[model samples]
Target: MPRDTAYLQIADALRERIRAGEWTAGARLPSRARFAEEYAVGQSVAQRAMELLIIEGFLEGRAGSGTYVRGPRRRMRIPRSRLRRLSGPGGRDNGGGTWQSRSKARTPAPERIAARLAIAPGDPCVVTSYAFLSQGRPVETCESWEPMAVTDRTPVVLPENGPLKGAGVIERMRAIGVTVVSATEIPRPARADQARADLLGISVGDLITEIERTHYAADGRPVETADIMVADRRAEVAYEITFGP
Candidate 1:
């Protein structure tokens, strides 16, 4: 078998055994020599398998000590239900977590962001940055952009200010008679850059999930768009769908 294939197979098998409770948390794993002997593979392949697991957050490597099973981290589920997230990121209400947002008004939208909002490039918009906290620790972060054309001069203009402060897209739009009706979220794997790592308190290059989201009004008008990031070790995203007649 190819080196890549061999290492992947070994990693998968080892992951299953670990999940099966063969080694409890903080337990030292067998040496690469032992694993190589058990799998009839080279020690290099065994080491690669161990490294994969370590990068996946399944095991921790100590400088002088051997790799050990990592303790379980909090795993919050992100519901994709339109109802749960209709308003905005962190709208699911899980874990009793709260978020704080800072909005800068009259910011010009960039080309791609303008495209997402269906507006002309450099159009004035309100840019809001959000940090969602759990136990006062940052678990997720988001950057939301709303075209000023849709909300300018309205009570809900600035996302975190005025009468409808922090009410989110759905309610804020509704308060201004915009009638938001649908939202779309596309989630993809990403690497935590320096800025992202600092926000989530993780090391750079860690795996993360980035969701591209947008809210639309009843007339198919794009009202709000955002980029939301969460560390994979911090939470998992789940899509909740309801079938109707």
Candidate 2:
């Protein structure tokens, strides 16, 4: 190892110690000076090692106090394959946990959303916002858009209204003779904006996962697009793939 990589090596050693239960969760670590002396490294190197662990979520700093191990993270698994299932008569349960939603109708689609749905900007769309919860705590939020051109007068026009309220995109489209065949998602790491942070009960600039999802029909027409946000500390996204013989 190079001389400049000493801090990283120290971080690795600290991480190993943490996993081995040397200092269990909520246990305070030695002061930086003590760490430097124990590891035979300079104070700056020891500080860098501590900083690395903090970023990696292994440890947290308390104001006017020393660093301590973080408790185990809480995580909810979101299965990608389950997005295709509909909630209706004889439909299988989505198992996405419980959720609550509020929706507004006749909202004009934003430019970026228009591009995703392949519709003209400013076109009228039904926007439904959702907040998913676990044990009464907010875990995820989603903003879904469906162009009025496809569902203007249909029973499923508004996602949270009419008989098909709370139904999935596949079921809603199928009811209107639109056969949804495919769905795609693009996920990226992001920081929580002010509004999202408030909704998810997290501080601004906290790490989050943003997923852009789109549903399509058999005729190659776009059915719906949505932006989903989950706090990194609360959920984990997983994809399931199967090979055909």
Candidate 3:
């Protein structure tokens, strides 16, 4: 916790405290003025600390309501390439692809997700959310889901636990005995919401990149679906189209 990094230090300290259950969810945090005095720092420093926590999803501030603890953050990462095979009720590979299981995670569904999955707005789905970091800083927050029928199997295997190298989702699934025949990708732009802003440490009005993908297997069966939001500043998806000469 260097002096110049005081705000981040304060935020990290508070984050740890919140995660440790010292400050329960919905518990109001100390006022900026109070924290300034408590920390023997200027009000600006205290305010910066609050902003850091807010951006990191540890705190939420309402218009009329003061800042308070929010529940655990949700982060998701799915490789763009691998085709995960759909497993039957018994978790055996059915020679068809399947989406990731819900049992591996617990996160809230974003409202717009249903449209991407072609499900009714209120329909229940299996969701997996996670954050991707490359250095110590956060890079992107991803939320992806599929109908339960597609992901009922337990322990959906992913690439070995270490950091992903050149392999993408397509390769990992193939390695696991699944094959992908086709994929469709759609792109859109959107205003950053509180959750997105917090996860990416950006402001509410910032532009974010949204990608929706639907994957199909050999028989044209929809095996998996995904919705991903990328921080515009940090990443961009590129592709090269080719035609036979």
Candidate 4:
């Protein structure tokens, strides 16, 4: 059998040690040069091994402090089934607390958002930015868009301004005589940008989960699209599917 590469071997050894509690959470590991000498590999290989562990959520890098075993992640389960339910005033009770949101109306839809809403690139839309918090700590952020063509002059033009403020997409559309039939979410792993990092209180380059979500009316009209961002170490998304009998 072909032997494992140097980095993989080193990474595996480190992983085992971590799992065995040789290095407890918050304990710093030796420098790359030291690890290379201990593992009989080049420093670059050791660095690669450390990077792998960081990406895998087993370790973290602190600028000028060195690498350390990551503490247990604080996770909140996001139920896909509950997303369609109408939320109370502030926002949905995410088992954390009432979510808070700030909104901007009459904003011109960005090109990508317009495409997602099946409208022209520069079409007017209402944008609502949400910061979901748990116990006063920011946990997730979402920016949602709705084309003006669908909600112009309607009571629901501004999502948060409507009488149904804080309601979910399906419920809000229903109030406007639009029956939302389906929703789709596509999630991708990403690195936190400067703005997001500041909002999330994490360092830039921290790992994040980005989800692109779209909701559609029964008539196949696009109703809304949103970009949701969550810190990797702060939440875990759970999808609950129920099959029809």
Candidate 5:
């Protein structure tokens, strides 16, 4: 009881300080010893509070360095639509638009994903995962990974229906310097898990579509990989092709 409520209250208080500019971006916060003393809370309580702030995107910590205020949080809004398409190294048609970030727990690169980027498995990669909601209810989730060797700090703000978010993977890769020539997608059918069912508001074992895709650069090097899962009942998957030369 003491630890739970105290930690939340401390986090809430610190959240306000960041919003009020009491701590500016990139400013290092006091050490845990100082925070415990200043907040009149136990060290454990203070530590938990800091953890919460980090998750809430108010602060960041470097291993050898101390915790510091995050630079301004970027604000973005993805569009909502029924149409689906893939873009990037792999022709991953993300089920829908999503928020992308590079935080510790959710880095863009996973081992398999890094392989698609033509880097050693687990090398750093750009990552963004999207949650698709309809009428305020969750319906699907999608995640995409790109190697940092290619992205290299380029701003990746994908807007719903926007070029990067809407166009198929090949085009997006070209914009980033890689020219994606072809893609392979593997589609599979599976039952929803508890988390997927809850998000899509469907029963467990409900039919869902899972797609894993990899895109190859002009040199035949894989440039990106994506995983897309969609709720079958709530959404339909379709594709149309236009002739071009």
Candidate 6:
């Protein structure tokens, strides 16, 4: 452990002590001032160290109470299988969680989003956002965008509304005589922003997994695109691929 960074060094020492079961799960920790005194560091440094542990899922904070040891973090597995067809765009996960969604029609697409949909910037689109929770705790979030040129005035216009509600991208498009051929997803590491952190109930600056996904029609036209954000500490993203015969 590098002592140059006082907080991290303190965090390491504290983490080892926690791992040794000195403070069992649900055990209340001493106040920040107490920790600072014991570690011979400033109170702010001790607080930051505790915050790091909280973000790591080893500790939790209570509204009116001090921090306490957290139980083993349960990391849900989120599958990303090429063989599995997506249920439209926003809010798709295999974490056995429920999701709530809100959508808007005729929303204008920004420059980057429009490029993914192969449409001019400001083109009309339907946008949907989803918040996914597992065991009553937030685990993931998604934002989906689809070009109005493809789904406007159609039953699938609103992803979670109408007759084909909750249908997958392929099925929904097929209903309107459009054949979806394939989907592409690009996943990358990201840090939680204030908005995302608040939604996922995680601390800002925490690491997260971001997947950018796009669906395509038979004519090589982009049908839908989405960005999925999963809490890296509470979930694991898995990719399962099999060879074709």
Q: Pick the candidate with the highest TM-score.
A: 4
Top candidate on lDDT is: 1
lDDT of 2 by residue, 141-235 (tens): 88889999999989999887889787788878889999999877788988777888898887666567888888898988888988888776667
Candidate no. 4 TM-score: 0.81
lDDT by residue for model 3 (1-245), tens = 35688887777777888889998999998888988887777778888887667655678765556888876565333233222211211112212233232223333345576555555666655555545554445455555464554433433432222243124445434553557577777778776788788877765655567777766656565555666666654444443354666
What would the TM-score be for candidate 1 when compared with the true structure? Answer: 0.79
**lDDT, candidates in the order shown:** 0.84, 0.78, 0.56, 0.77, 0.63, 0.83
Poorly placed runs, candidate 5 (over 4 Å): 1-84, 87-108, 155-168, 241-245
lDDT for position 190 in model 3? 74
RMSD of 4: 3.6
Error of 5 at 47 (Å): 53
**Candidate 2 displacement at residue 59 in angstroms:** 3.7
Reference-based lDDT, residue 218, model 5: 85
Clashing pairs in 6: 88-169
lDDT of 4 by residue, 28-138 (tens): 998999988897778888998988888678998776588999944556765545343224221254585557677777889888998899988888888888888776777
How well is each residue in 1-245 modelled by candidate 1, as lDDT tens digits?
68779999999999998999999899999999999999999999999898788767787665457888985455777666767776565564656688888889999999999999999999999999998887777778889999999999998898888997877789999888899888888889887777888888876666788999998999999999999888777677787778986
Query: Over 4 Å off in model 3, which ranges?
Result: 1-125, 154-178, 243-245
| Cα TM-score per model | 0.79, 0.76, 0.45, 0.81, 0.51, 0.74
Better of 4 and 5 by TM-score: 4
* Model 6 CA deviation exceeding 4 Å by range: 1-17, 22-71, 83-85, 88-95
Model 5 residue 188 CA deviation (Å) reads 0.6
